[model samples]
Target: MRPIAILSVLAGLSALTSPAASAQDRPPRPPAFASPEVTAEKKVSFRIHAPKAEKVQLSSSDLPDAGRGLDMTKSDEGVWEATVGPVVPGAYRYSFNVDGLAVIDPRNPATSEANNNTFSLVYVPGSETSDAKDVPHGAVAEVVYPSQTLQRPRRMHVYTPPGYEKGEGRFPVFYLLHGATDSDASWSTIGRAGFILDNLIAAGKARPMIVVMPAGHTGPFRFGGAGGVSFETQMAQFEQDFVKDLKPYIETNYRVIADREHRAIAGLSMGGAQTLNVAFGHLDEYGAVGVFSSGVFGITGGPNGGAPDTRWEDAHKSTLDDAELKKGLRLVWFGCGKDDFLLKTSQATVEMLKRHQIDVVSRDTVGGHTWLNWRDYLVEFAPLLFQGK
Candidate 1:
């Protein structure tokens, strides 16, 4: 080899054998830390490491004064923290705002999502009924079935009891639903349905039954109206898809007691309206109905829902007074928060039903339109279903 070529070969060999190429070139890892350390007193403390950020805050709908963000104080090491609440027991969605950017706790893996955003989840475990306990847990399944009405496949979440696969007998079903902008997964995740049901079933408070959580947003829905697809049109379409499509699919696929007396339906917010549309209109399908924090929208005092030419009452007047519906329904349950924006609408709904000589159970709670109340409502509602059978 030529002298220059020999030198070049030696340089290549030295570079190949160098420690920098093997190990020293790797970047340093960040310091170890843990977030969301809950104190023994049940206070939730949130932490984040953002060295360059000027401001950080903790945001959560579950907080008592969430409108004013929980201000976090930064340490000399750039770790920011804020502690609040002897908070109520349930799963609450939270996000860390670092210098105006909303982000999840990087140190935490538990999370939940909304239609437009994502959030980290924290469980404050004190409640006997809502907390995930050491019990025979059920299985929650994501099911996709054909929607012949809309010409596409739709998704739903179905929760089967602990021994559903091994058991030979069938179980009654309760159809639960989510509010607007939330998907079918809401009940399983932040809503904590699985845990609640597991504990309830194990404790013999609720019967071992299947819970079906279906997506409620079937069409264009916003605060105002969509261009052509109005709320009534969308709700009507949902009613059709639900009664005609999803019910049949669930009945044929699952091991269910396939009759009205064994089936019930319930929902919150937008879902509450959907529940009314499905259960009230199709009286022969469901024996019990639960409406939480909602009623017919477009009523004058309804929550942010704009005025429609005809409210839900104007449309469902005949159906509400139907003898088959009155006779077939085992229980008509209505629960609304005292501070909920839709309290008046719920009140109107109950009053209207009562005028027609229909019996309804109206429950008034202490919170606003939120998951805190919904969780409690579910615990109370689940035990009441299929009791007459």
Candidate 2:
């Protein structure tokens, strides 16, 4: 062996056996991956490395108190880390408070799936939809219809029942409404209305019926307007827009059952008021009505309470009266959470209907007026439609 080569080999071996090794003598090891697990019953830890930041904080909407705010400490390579304790999962919306500016976790790629800027979800154990298996589900689509009332084209979304696009069978239709400060996209985006219906239809709980979601806000109120003042006029305009323009377009474009017996209407909050004003008043058009949270009449029976005083005929001059409601209406189903701001209004509407000998299926829950409550209401309500022979 050459003396130089032998000496080099001996030095390398000596370095391995010695307490310290030369700078070039050691080989690099691979980086380590983080293995973190969480359960629904217990809390989970989350760590983020952001070493250069001056201050870091964590905030979550689900937590009663502000989330654990971490002051990041620098590592050898100038990386900062923030660690927080276990949190109950179920799609927790959280953001990092970096220097007082809220930010989503850049290291986490899953938050990108939602396409939301300020919020991210953490799926905990035992979520109903999270736990459910992939089954045959319905489809949702965005569609545009011509509107003569607004003097422009209108856009809306529809969720077709399972086997609808493929099969030759005709299906019933339900026209759903969204609340104020929300658009036609609200139901599909936040509520997951299509997914909920798909699950129900797959389980045979709901009939194969087409679901339509429409924007109920009209005029300046659409952008942002207060109730009691702009609501009546705006609501009236919405009714006209729905009946004169939207309805005809849907009938022409889709293979929907056009008769009143095959059509229904429902909504949440401001949309709920629209549901009652439009569906009940125009019972000749919509056979069934689902009223959630908001109602057309308040308990006081005054002009702004919920329903009109004296009689509904005087309040809604052109629409049908109570006697007509009894003749044309098939079902009036209403639900609201006990803690909802609109609870009293919903109760008053129910009493007014019942007093006029109108039958109703009323339900109440314990949640505040929130999307989670509404989603569950839909999960329950979808099955009740088109049940009778």
Q: Using lDDT as the measure, which candidate wins? A: 1
What tens-digit string does per-residue lDDT give for candidate 2 at 312-356? 535654444357645767778889999887787788778766766
All candidates: TM-score: 0.89, 0.70
In model 1, the runs with Cα more than 4 Å from the true position are: 1-28, 219-222, 225-234, 301-310
Candidate 1 lDDT (Cα, 0 to 1): 0.85
Residue 280: error of model 1 in Å?
1.5
> Once model 1 is optimally superposed onto the true structure by TM-score, how far is the C-alpha of residue 63 displaced, in angstroms?
2.0
Candidate 1 lDDT tens digits, 221-271: 564565435666667777778877898999999999999899999999989
What C-alpha RMSD separates each model from the true structure?
Answer: 3.2, 9.3
- The lDDT, on a scale of 0 to 1, for candidate 2 is 0.69
Candidate 1 structure, TM-score to reference: 0.89
Instruction: Give me the runs in candidate 2 sitting further than 4 Å from their true place.
Output: 1-132, 219-233, 297-313, 316-325
